[model samples]
Each structure stands twice: as structure tokens, then as C-alpha cells.
Target: MAEPTAPPAAPSLQELQHWTGVLGRAQQMMMEAGIDMMAQLPAAKAAPAFPAMFDPAQAMRAGAAFWTDTLELWQRFLDPAHAVRAEESPEHARDRRFRAPQWREDPVFDFLRQSYFLIADHMVKGVDSLEGVEPRQKEQIRFATQGFIDAMSPTNFPATNPEVIEKIVETRGENLLKGLQNMLADIAKGQMTQSDTSAFELGRNLAMTPGKVVRRTPLYELIHYAPATKQVFETPLVIFPPWINRFYILDLTAEKSFIRWAVEQGLSVFVVSWRSADASMKDVVWDDYVERGQIDAIDTVRELLGVEGVHAIGYCVAGTTLAATLALLTARGEADKLKTATFFTTQVDFAEAGELSLFVGDEQLKMIDSLSSDGYLDGRYMATTFNLLRGRDLIWNYVTNNYLLGADYAPFDLLHWNADVTNLPAKWHQSYLTDLYRDNKLVMPGAMQIAGTPIDLSTVKTPSYIQAGREDHIAPAHSVWKITDHFTGPLRFVLAGSGHIAGVVNPPSANKYQYWTNEAKVSSLAEFVAGATETKGSWWPDWLQWIEAADATRVAARGARIPGKGKLQALADAPGEYVKTR
Candidate 1:
């Protein structure tokens, strides 16, 4: 009647219930079929004639044991009074209110969060593709999957959903408890705060290493080491460690120290330890470092111990300085005093300096200019720059372990030494960056000048030994090897294992570390690169062999005296006061 309208559009309770029941039945049927198929899959995959040695009994027992322990832990954690207090805690309240909404409101982040689950769902289907993977590899893959799932579980998500909130609270509480326990354990084991003490001790030890004060025209300390017995060579050995850090990196510790090793090997070792710059040293330029730092030390060594010539070992930036010094001396016909020179982990060419190039661009130069306007390149600035190069390991690792994990810092002497920062004269640093890094001028003939003479490496007739590390990111191998081509001397280039610091600190005990040497003559790096083979052991032994051949036979021992003068006044001991002056 009511216009013969369609039956009142309404779902009766009975109809609704019937449809729900049918849906329930269909879901049950699908679940049962899925379970059955899953159960038969392993049987189908079982090797041809033999059944799997399925240890269901053992698995059941293990599951029972795990559940039993879990129940006990759950009971302890769910104490009513404690649970109520934890729920009302500040952290919990913060998480429940502000943090959850803030996290969800991030647009790009929400997209990523939703996309993760979709990708994970697809990955579950992709597991079938791994059927032929090795059993161990399959287990590894499963473990990795579980690990990722655990990391991304609701417990780690900040959300308003009841399940996610509860899980987050529970997991964070557990983590807090574990962290406190670890802190206490470390304190009891005497591992906590060891880093600070170790660093302090390293500074103390470096300050105590005896250094000699050799007074020349330019006042600087010359750390000298002469073997107890007759010297192996008539040529004195002088070591010029880079001024970027302290000179003592080559003499870090007695057992593994390079300077100690060279001294014990019967070579006269003289190291140039530059003083930390003061207001007076503000105008010191690159030429000043060579003239006052290297050349003055050379004159002191020559005058103090009258030697026919000296063998020089220059490392990193010091090597560059030494090469320039050699060129200058050659131009003036004064290079006859140097018989041989060795460069360690040093770069003459800047075409491919790797990560170091990134920080030397215009912006950084401007920043340096602003800061160094006071005449000194602040040591802190330099330290921060180097630290940024490997921030994950250098900076963030310590932050996470110290602040988050509440773990004690592990002290390493080398790291302590590295952190002993030193400032560079602003003029020297700015000129270095602009000339060497920006222009790559030092390696180019007639591009660099020292003491008013155009310096060129081809005129460097001193027999040369060049060493670089394969894993050195600061100075790429290609950039370092370019020095060989620029020189006409009998050059031997060795490639060592490890990075910049480790490469220099390498000792014979590190036998597993390998190096490459070209026994046959090779003109360029390309030629040597083609024929090089990896050989085990430290490159020091090889360097020593080359040095011994260049050194002259030892003559009668002369007392410690400045040559061309009356007998020299003796200093306290071998390691004099100069190096110990910080």
C-alpha cells in the first residue's frame, strides 16, 4: 500500500546474525585449509624415501620451559603497585600524550611508516624464492628477518593506539632497567671511566718523553736518538713528523713506537718537535716552518753531530714540507747534505684527495678566514673538521655508548694522542689549503717557491722512498703515488695496509698487515699498479733495507758536540728537554 514501496529498508537482528554466522563459517574454513596446506608442505618437501627427524617432543619441551620462565618474569613485572606507579611516571605520561601525536603528525615520516609494513608483507611472499638457499644461509636470513621485525615492532613506535602505547611503555621500562644493571656491572668491574684516566696517562707519558733542546738561529727543540753502540750508517737520520698533531705520534709508546724501533735499529733519529704557537708566532708562514722547523733542525744536527749528510724521513704534511725544502736546497746547490729521503703517507698531488677535498671548498675557506683573522688557525677548529670526516665512529659511537648504553668508555692510547690538538699558524694553513688543495700547485713544476727559489720535485736528486696506505682515505693512493713520477731519483714506493694513523704506527708485530712493493723498475704508478702483488709483514723492514744501502759505514764515535766549534756541552740525556716542553 504505501505506494507499494520496497520492503522497509532495514536489516532485522535475525538477518544480521545469520550473515555474521556465515562469515564466521567461511573464515573458519579458510583458516583450516591454510593450516592443512602448511602442515602438508613440509611432508611434500621431505627427502624422497626418508621421513624428517622432526623433534616435536624436544620443541614442545623447550617451548614449555620458555613459557614457564616467561610466566615468572611476567608475574614479577606486573606487580600491581609498581605497575600503577610506572603508568603515572613522567616518562610514561609524556609518551602517552605529547610524543605520540608529535610522531604521527610528521607527514613524510607517516608515509614511510605505512610503507614499511607493505614492503614487509611483500617480503614474506618473497621468502619462497629462497627455497634453494643453503641451510645455514636460510637460518641467517630467518634470524635477520626476526631481528628487523623486533626492531620495528609496535613497542618501538610512538602511537596513541592502546596496543602500541602499552608495548612502548613496557619495552622502554625493560631497557631502562637493563641499562642501569649494565652501568652497575661496569662500575664493579673497574671498566667505567677508564677512558679519562687513560687519556690523562697518555698526556703525562708524552710530556715525560725526554726531548733535547738544540739552540739554533730559530729556537726549537730537536728530539735526538743515537744508538748506544756504533751507528750503522755515517749518514745521520732525521725524522720530521707532521705538525698537524704532536711530533710524538711516531714515538707514542716504547713497545710499538716507530721512533723507538728506528733508534734501536742503530740509526741516528732526530725529530723536530714544534712548539705550540703563541701570539708571537702568529705571522709564521709555510717558509718559516721549513726554514725554522726543518732547515734549522738540519743545521743543528749537522753542526751538533758533524755528519757528511743526513737521511730524512718525513711523514704526512711534513713530507710535503721536506720535499719543498729539498727542492729549495737543490736550487741553491745545498742539497748535497741530504743523502736520502723517505715520505710516509704523504701527498704531493691534490687532484684526488678524497673526503678531505670536500671540506676545503670556498665555504670552508671563508669560515677559516673568519676564524683565523686573529692570526692562528684554532686547533679546536682543525680537530672538529677531522672528527667530522668519520663522525659515526669518532663522535656518535661515543655518544650512543656513553649516554644511551651507559657504557664505560674504553681508552686507547692512540686516540688519546690524536685528541691532543695543536693549532697552525693562520698564514701557513690558509696558504696550504689554497696552494696545495685548491690549486694542486706544489706538485706542478715551477708552481711552488721556497726561500725565493722556484721548487721542483724533478730536481730533487736525493734517493727517495715513498710509502702510502691502501685504505688511506685522506690521501688516496693515486694522489700519493704521483710524487714518484715527479721525481727522477731512485724511488721505491710501498703500499701499506690500514688508514693514515694505523699505517704510520704499523709495527712488525702486525704481521697480518700486508704491503706492496715493486722490485722491478717501474716508471709510473700505472706501471707499478699492473705488476704489484700483496706481501705480508710490516713495510718497516723493507724501508730499513733500502735505508741501510744508502747509509755510509759508521766512523769513530764523536762525542756530542756542535761541529766546527769546540767540544759540545752535553745535555741531560738522549731525549732532551725540547720535546718534553709540550
Candidate 2:
């Protein structure tokens, strides 16, 4: 009997149907009321009149109405017994003492209170305006009344105090509206941070495996590139990435990785991953980055690969160092070993450095001098400076989205990669800012010297590919393109899309962005400017073609591998550990 009674068929179909009908009716009623209220909205916006609504006298009477409605609603939802229990909790007690709404001191709270009065004043004026209305117009009046009442309803405010919510609505209405619009625009721009590509995973996988560290006599790593065929080039390719960051920018990820792409294209590639400098490296000047960093890497690649000479690629700050190194090599009649050189978004002239000019002025320089007096530029300082350049998009946008919108935006691996910043040696930063930015001395023939030798770009005859970014704020395209004037050999100037990082790490797949090329045979920037054609497609293909043409002839036979080791040591993988460190 108990089993028979237990089920009661768990409410038969008819009972369920009845309940569903009730819910449907309730929903329909709400919708009808909402529609009726919305119908009363003005066909056209009314003209604005200052001091016509929410006058101080009207607000006083309105405030009384809001207080009465708010207290009734609060009492229903928040029982006095529940409040007493909540107060018993230590967390609640602390919040009540320190975080409770202090209307007197809080501007936001005061504004919300004022909004309550404003609503009441408007309601009174609406009633007064309806004095001459006929019986048929009574329905329309009721609709309008309902609309205003709905807007100021206690249920509309998420907070217990309706007055506080009202104040917030009044005080922050325009700003909140503007913020919402901006957020939508950012979403459309795809300027929002995104996850690093699947290619990043491939690169990370390659670099994490165990490998050998074959230290050259002086310094540097001779990374071997094993191609499909024995018919490889006579000249080795050595990549000199700046010590300012990690070397991985060249080899970023598999797809966008320039180093990997070169290897696939049949060019043997060797990238130098500079060691993180320690406190002892404070005295290590710009010369050390060139002679010791790039030159040493070149020699190791030559010896390991058994090539006649190496083709060098310098990126950003590394490019400048390479220019200096080339000058020194040329002065000593040692430039014959080098083939072609490529500079990616690198600046040699500093006079028109764009926004960077502001931070490198006299007062800023003095501050930097004091900070870097201990020798190495602190990494945090450098990161702060770059972050400031795009503060709205990079910093404030995230703050609003995360805190205000309560959006847990997924962290982009690339952004995470960017945030993992490394410190610069004090000597390098101080000398760079003063000599390059402040003094504008690098482009001059003998204005700057490395290792006591006057460095000059003209002396080095390596054909060059100088690429700049149109949207790049860090190194303006003009400042970078000026390098062509300093070089006597054939030069190709490319202007790509996006900022400094995106422009350089650009993949061929991102074909939406384009580059411009000056007319053929126009060697100088001025000539290019007059005859430049905006070309579609990625600059990577163009750069690859240029480098391939400039490359020295490939040997008929594969040169013998350096004799010393039978099984050469292998690098761990693609994205090495050094690149992963912050």
C-alpha cells in the first residue's frame, strides 16, 4: 500500500501540463505589460532643456518616494534574522565595518542617491503635463506611467538600496555607455589578445627536448641545420637575435618562425641565443654584444658547418650591433667572409624615432643614468616604458574587462610570451639611449665605434634587406628606412603592416596585411617614396626571394662537415628554454 501511494505517478502528464500553462500565462502577462510600457516612448527624442527636470525642490520629494519603496523591498528579501546570522560571521563583520556603503564619503554612492530624487521630480512633471488629457488618452497615460514606474522599480536595482543604484545610474550613465561602445569596437578590431597559434606548440615542443651545448672556443652556439639533400649552399646562415629579449623572435613558433622557414627553404640556419647577463655583466658594453655575441657566433657557425662565410640576419637591437660588427670587420679587411645581411624593423638613425623621443630627453636620461648606475638596466623599467606606449589597449582595456565586466579573458600565449620579459644589462641600455636616441650618433660614418674601431655601414659591402613597419611606433619606418642611404650596396626597403612585434613575426598566412616596395633601381629612400607601390600579400615571400637572389652560389658538392666530431651535438628543439624565461 505504501509503495502504491509513494509514486502518485510523480505528477501525471495533466498536472505537469497545468503547471506549464500557469508559467506560460505568467510570462505572457509580463511580456504584454512590457510591450504596453515601451509603446509610450516618444516617437522622436525631446529637446534638451537644462534645469527643467530634477530641480533641487523636485528631488527632495522624489527621494522620499525612493526610500519608501526601497525599504519595503529590502525587508521582504533580507529578513532581520538572516541579517543577524550574517553579522555573526567574521568575514561579514569585517565587511560591515570597513566595506559598508559610506554615502557621505563615496562619490559614486552620493550620485546614486541624487538619481533617486531626479526620477521622482520627472514623475511629478509627467503627472502635471497630463491634466488636459481625454478619457481615450487615459490608456496612453497609464502606459507612460507604467513605463516610468518600471524604470524606477526596486527590482531593477541589483543593490538593496534603490537610492544608491539610482545615484550610480545618474553619475556614470554617459561614461558607462561610452565604455560599452568602446568594448564592442575593441571586440570587432580583433585587437583583443588571442592565444598563440598551434605552431607555437610545435616550436615549444622542439626546444624542450634534451640536447647538447657545444661551447665554441670563445663563445656562441653552432646550431646545425640538416636538410633533405647533400647539395646545400656554400655560405652558412647565422642569425643574430638581440640579447634585449630571447633569440626565439626569429624562430618564434614553427609557422611564423623565420629560422625554421629558412631551413625548410634549403638554407642552413644557425641562431645565436644570447646568455642571460648577470651582475658581473654590468661592464659589458655594446661592443660585447657585437664582437663577442655576433662575431663569435659567426665564427662558430663557419667552423662547425665548414662554410666559406656566413650570411647574417640581425633583428631589432641586434641589427644595429651587427652593423657595428660589420664595420669593425671591414676595417680589418675581414668583410670578405660575410655574404648578405638582413635587418628586420631595425633603426640605425634616431632623429625621427617617433614617440620614443619623449622618453629619451635630458631629464629622462638623467633618471636612467641614476637607475642604471649599478651597470645593467633593470628589466622591469624597460617593460614599464614599452607598456606605457599602448597603455589604453594593453593595460586599461584589460582592467575594465576583467574587473568591471567580470570577464575571465583567456590569457594569450603570445601575450604571456611578451610579459615574460628579460632585463637588459645596464651598460647596454645607458649607452643605447644616450648614443642612439638622445645623441642620434649611430648613423654618422664614424660617430660610433665598437672595440676602438670606427664603425661605418658604407665600408661593409654586404647587400641588405631593410624592412620597416608602417604602424610601428617603437621604430618609425622613416628612421629604419634611412639605413639604405648609409649602405652603398644593393638594398631593398620593405614596409610591412602591424606594430613592431606583429610586423616582424608576421606569417605568410596573415595575408590581410601588406607591404610597399619602391620602384626597382631606386636605391635611396627618397626615390622609393616617390615611386613606391603598395603591394598585396605578406612581405615574407618578397624578403625570401630577395635573400635567395642575393645569396652566394651553392656549391656543386656538399662541403665536408667540420672534421672534429662524428655525431654533432643536437639542439634540444625549436623553442629553447632560454626563449621561455621571463
RMSD list, candidates in order: 19.8, 19.1
Distance from true location, Cα of 18 in model 2, Å: 49
Considering every candidate listed, which one attains the maximal lDDT? 1
Candidate 2 error regions (>4 Å)? 1-213, 216-222, 225-231, 521-527, 555-577, 580-582
Instruction: Give the per-residue lDDT digits (tens) of candidate 1, residues 1-582.
Output: 356544333345575456445433533343344334333433224423212212466435544654453334233223422432112235333532223442344322222233333333333333333443444333333433433433343323334123333443766655445546655654675332224444444335543333344442333566655454554456778888887888778877665678778766767667777766645667888998888878877877787677757888889999988999998888889997788999988888888776676566565688898988777776767876776565545554443344344445676767766666677788889899999988989888888888777898888878999998888877878789888778787888998888888876888976758888878887667787689887887889889899888864775434562222324444445344433443
- State the local distance difference test value for candidate 2: 0.60
lDDT of 2 by residue, 49-101 (tens): 32232356654665566445444423422342343211123532342212334
lDDT of each: 0.63, 0.60
Give TM-scores for every candidate, taking all chains together and pairing residue i with residue i: 0.66, 0.62
Model 2 alpha-carbon miss at residue 104, Å: 32
